[model samples]
Target: MLMYCEDPSSFCSLVLNITSATGNFIGNQLDLLYLGWVASLLYPAILVFIILPSLILVLLYISAFLLYIYMRRKKVYNVLNETLHRDPWASGRYLISLLWDAHGYIWHGYEVRGLENLPDEGPCLIIYYHGAIPIDIYYLVARTILTKGRLIHCVGDRFLEKVPGWKVILEAFHITPGTITSCVQTLSENNILSISPGGVREAQFSDHNYQLMWGNRTGFAKVAIESKSPVVPLFTENLREAFRTVSWPQRLWIALYEKLRFPIAPIYGGFPVKLRAHLGEPIYHREGETVEELAQRIRASLNSLIQRKQKLPGNILRALLARFYEPTKNE
Candidate 1:
């Protein structure tokens, strides 16, 4: 090898070139290895964050639709036909029961306290804080049907009527208009009625502070007074964390809702967060109480329930962790 070199400097240059090539080759391989490691992590992250949640929601709705078809085929009771024989299993209560067992218990592990406050019989008014999706309220409704064999009438927002194909379902659930007349009639008929005074506005705009957006809506209180129904205050812990609406541009959404009464905000989060529903002591309307006075009392009771049970500025991670461990009330 030494005899073959015509120029010593040239030979030295060749040796240095070979060394540099070897070093570069090793560095390239190391970079490839690091990139592969990152790919492995990113794939699972995509699955967890994007794919799995969508799949879960799709499966939930599909199963519910299938169950509804099965129930309909059985002809236990016709949803539109008032003359049909009353069958509990054929009713909306049965559907809610199935949903409770499948989603509430297994996935969210939802629980309710002060269920005893719900009267065994008679007309009662339940006013609950509406969450972003109000899925917890669905769980509560399901639980009530499962335990009490009684249906809780709901006064839905006027917008629900505008949704195509929801008419039959709404009728089956006994969801009447949020009018004072409809609410009073529901209570006078000795039905346990549930109403959310904040309605769509609260669901769309309320933040972690859990502020009640009731704001001078005394219709529910007036209905209670007219029907002589005991008003029960209800709040669910960590409701804001489980499903949240887009916070930015909240003012625009609020204004649109106030004027047009449309729900236009984007909502996210379907985490398996622990949910607990608490019902405060039922407040009866006093003989001399005006509508404003009754409404204020109800609002205060609901706020008290939220303060006593929920941790302020709810954290999504903590809400998810609550699935594994118990949640403590904020001091």
Candidate 2:
């Protein structure tokens, strides 16, 4: 065999021929497979990302328009019948309640304890352990509306006011800052004031659900004392299930975005979760107690209530039983 193929040119030609044939076969196969893959993916990808999204947007717009029309008609009738006395806040609250109910009933699948502790009448300060998400506020609003048409003014951060449409929504809900003047004005109007003393730091730090952000929150108690309002300690379990907050790079990005006045927390949920809020017995302000003393007392009350609840076994049976139990009315 070596003698027969002694010419170097002949051997080189044989090797080149084999290599060219192998390359051509692989190239042809790849082209055929790639073409088939493209044909299979093209239509489905277009339908999913483009056409489907457009259809969803159109349907949402039409639904929103119809809802607005229905609400407007009801409002006009209420005004004409002199049933509502042209109160926009009342109308807004009614609409919000209706919307809330339609999506999901209040405490329908959740449980609320300590409702008996909430005052039946008069200006009071309701402070709760704020959750990672702000769903606790919605639960409080729903509860307040059902119990008494007493408006609950929330002391929110100045950052929320900077967001484009958020300022309007917050204002409509009578949510103000956790400032002294604002607290005094809100209480003087005979309206209940709700404050989460933990502010943004709590929301950021409480990555796990049900974990409180309040290590040192005394301003709420001071507000209650100065306003002569009783401090109502509130606790919400399972409220964190509504939405999970970003913990890492996403959290860092969100903080920066918030600084730029943008809502960076990406949250998506249908029909708000059935969050339950427990209102503890009121702690009245002493006649001449210092603000520090008042704050400490309020903190102690809240911390104790939360600790007691935490000791309970987090089992499905307990949750179901709680949901079925009716809350006792405040005396």
Candidate 3:
């Protein structure tokens, strides 16, 4: 023990021990600082990407549930015997109306021009370009309920039946399985029905080109002819900007969807963009018009509407900024 004072080498050894301890302490402090820095980056990312979206989704579900309960308790969803066909599931209809109204107002500020073109009464066929998610359809339906007190029965993808727990909601919304017969019947009964001739293919692969994928698909035209309902060509401005499929490897997804009848494209974006649906004057089927001819005429009419209303290669930023500004006279 006396070597501490007597032996120089022993004193050097003690100093070395102190230096080693100091180095380890500093290294540990640096490691902690590094960990803190990493955590600082990770936490916000978790909050934004994971927590916030999940919370928002949960909030929506909760809100829907509460609204449903309130409607049920108030007997607001019941169908009166006389108006059963006109306003089925009054409570559900009302709840959905509120939800879509809030969504259209807050998220997109959606509006329908030429709504006057939609008859106040009688059968009509509304054929619109299908967006990646077709959210605009809901807005149109809700707007119809609010403006005309009429329900716009929709022809939905057949795969909608495969979605678990969606059947009831689909029925409530009068979303019929996509079939020529059902469409014809809906229109024959003097109901307003909407369908997309392009359906999932156009929604998946059309990109921002505003092209119709209704190749040789004249069933809707036949429905219009058989039901004797005037076809209303509808197109929404900035519809492509609201949602889009992933661009990379899109052809592969389209191929898969074609074979399996499944929407395989990864859809993204629900930007708070401006969405306006323009309805052209209703086109009636001429006596000599073939189904193919009728379909082509409607397709061309819709394309012209698109060319007039939407810019090619739609810009998401421009659409988003449109929420704050009014449309121009030319637009």
2 against 3, candidate with superior lDDT:
3
User: How much lDDT does candidate 1 score?
Assistant: 0.83
Candidate 1 similarity to native, TM-score? 0.75
CA RMSD of each candidate after superposition: 8.2, 7.7, 7.3
Compared with the true structure, what per-residue lDDT tens digits does model 3 show for residues 1-331?
4324345478677886787799999999999999999999999999999999999988986786566445444333343223656455765676677678667866788888999988888899999999988988888887787657788999888899899999988988888776888788888788899989889888888978888888788898999999999999899988889899997897788678769989898889988899988999999999999999999999999999998888776889888888888666355
Give the 10-residue window scoring lowest on summed lDDT in candidate 3. Answer: 73-82
Clashing pairs in 1: none
TM-score of 3: 0.78
Candidate 3 contains a number of clashing pairs equal to 2
| Candidate 2 residue spans exceeding 4 A from truth | 1-86, 104-111, 249-274, 311-331
**lDDT per residue (tens digit) for residues 4-38 in model 2:** 33465797767866877999999999999999899
lDDT of 3 at 174: 84
Model 1: runs farther than 4 Å from truth? Answer: 1-84, 87-92
Determine which window of 10 residues in candidate 2 has minimal summed lDDT.
Answer: 311-320
TM-score of each: 0.75, 0.66, 0.78
State how far residue 70 of model 2 sits from its true place (Å).
12
RMSD of 2: 7.7
In candidate 2, list every pair of residues with a backbone clash: none
